[model samples]
Target: MLRGFYGAGAGMITQQRHSEMLNNNLANAQTPGYKGDNASIRSFPEMLMQAENVGAAPGGRNELIGSMNTGTYMQERTPNFAQGDTRQTENNTDMAIVQGDVPVNEEGNSGALFFNVANEDGDLRYTRNGSFAVDGEGFLTTAQGNYVLDDAGDEIFVNNEEFTVDAGGNVFDDDGEELATIDISFAAAPEDLVKEGDGLLAVPEDEDALPTAIGDDDINYDINQGFVEESNVDLMRTMSDMMESMRIFEANQTVLQAYDQSMERAVNDVGRLQ
Candidate 1:
């Protein structure tokens, strides 16, 4: 009976965590370049039960019973990296990257690249949010004012000369003079990247997080200058998941209540007879 109570409690805790993850995904459904996360649950190991003594055919002997499942727990929250839909902003500063040869929309091309930006502490990070603007210093920077890095890993500085960025990521002035090339870097292993807050991905400080080179045939390297990527979360799916989690949570609560009542009866009502 005690084991049953523990199992129910574990279930309630796991369900609470799952609900939290679903809520987070729902809240970020409209966030640009936002990725959804899912909670993974793992069951506790089952314990083998054995009878102290049992009767075999015409003989008394010890026998093995079955196994009993203990409970489940939240293992980890895994982020989904599937590509999101793109929206055309018609803003010259907005940009988006194409994951592969199959474009996300008509404007997309083949490429697996991300824009590199620096934080206030000068620590480099990567992002797919291409909503950029020119700062007072005539430097291309993110909305948070982080300087965008170029191919040389330097801050890209541009004057208010009506600049344009091409699919090849080259910047040009109003006079058609090539000013600077925008940096589009590829991650050799994107799975190793970890999500920091504010739509940024951070590589471990100890690992070499430099962009890996790819041949022209391998990637289209196309950059759309007037678009932004939307969050990959599916609202309908998230709603359904949320409902399911709530139901499971209520079930666990019911089990816990039943166990509590059983214990109460055993202690108060049954103990009175003694």
Candidate 2:
């Protein structure tokens, strides 16, 4: 009876976490370059049940019953790196990365591309958000004021908003003078990148910054100016998944209530033994 309570309670907690993830996806549906997360649920190891305080079997071994499951929980959450549709904003600073065929990692997962930026402490970070702006100091920066990095791992100084970025990520001023080339980083396993808030992805502390995606003949990609990539979240699917998760939560709640009632009967009627 106690095991039943534990199982039902675990199920409810798992579904609650799943629902929260789906809700987060819905909230970021309109965010540019946002990737939705998928939940992975796994069951605990099954335990072998044996008769207790009973006589030994033919060979002096306890009688074996059946296997019983403990419960389930959410194991991990992985982000989906599928590219989203690009929308033309007609703004020169806006850029969009259109990824093509790329080398797959040993895990059989395709690699991904991202724009390199420097955080407040000048630490390297990655992001797909292309809504850039030229700061007062003639340096290109993200919405959060992070410096946009060039191919040489230096900050890109465009001097003005009237600059053009070519397919090769070369930044050319209005007078046609090449200033710098935008840096595009490649992640063989993008899921390993940690998602920091404010549209930035950070490399693990123990890992080095990702390598540039340029000069790789096998890697094909294009940077489009005056455009931004939309979030890849599917609102309809997220809503449906949220509903299903809620239903499972309620089901578990009902099961837990049943267990509570059974326990009450055992304590009041069975234990009374009038």
TM-score of 1: 0.88
Candidate 1 stretches with Cα past 4 Å from truth are 55-60, 101-112, 213-216
lDDT score for candidate 1 against the true structure: 0.80
Give the best candidate by lDDT.
Answer: 2
Candidate number with greatest TM-score: 2
Q: Model 2, residue 119: what's the lDDT?
A: 92
Candidate 1, residues 67-147, lDDT tens digits: the string is: 999999999886776678889999888887757653232334232467888988898888877888999889989988998
Task: Give the alpha-carbon lDDT of every model.
Answer: 0.80, 0.93
Question: lDDT value for candidate 2?
Answer: 0.93
Tell me how many clashing residue pairs each candidate has: 1, 0
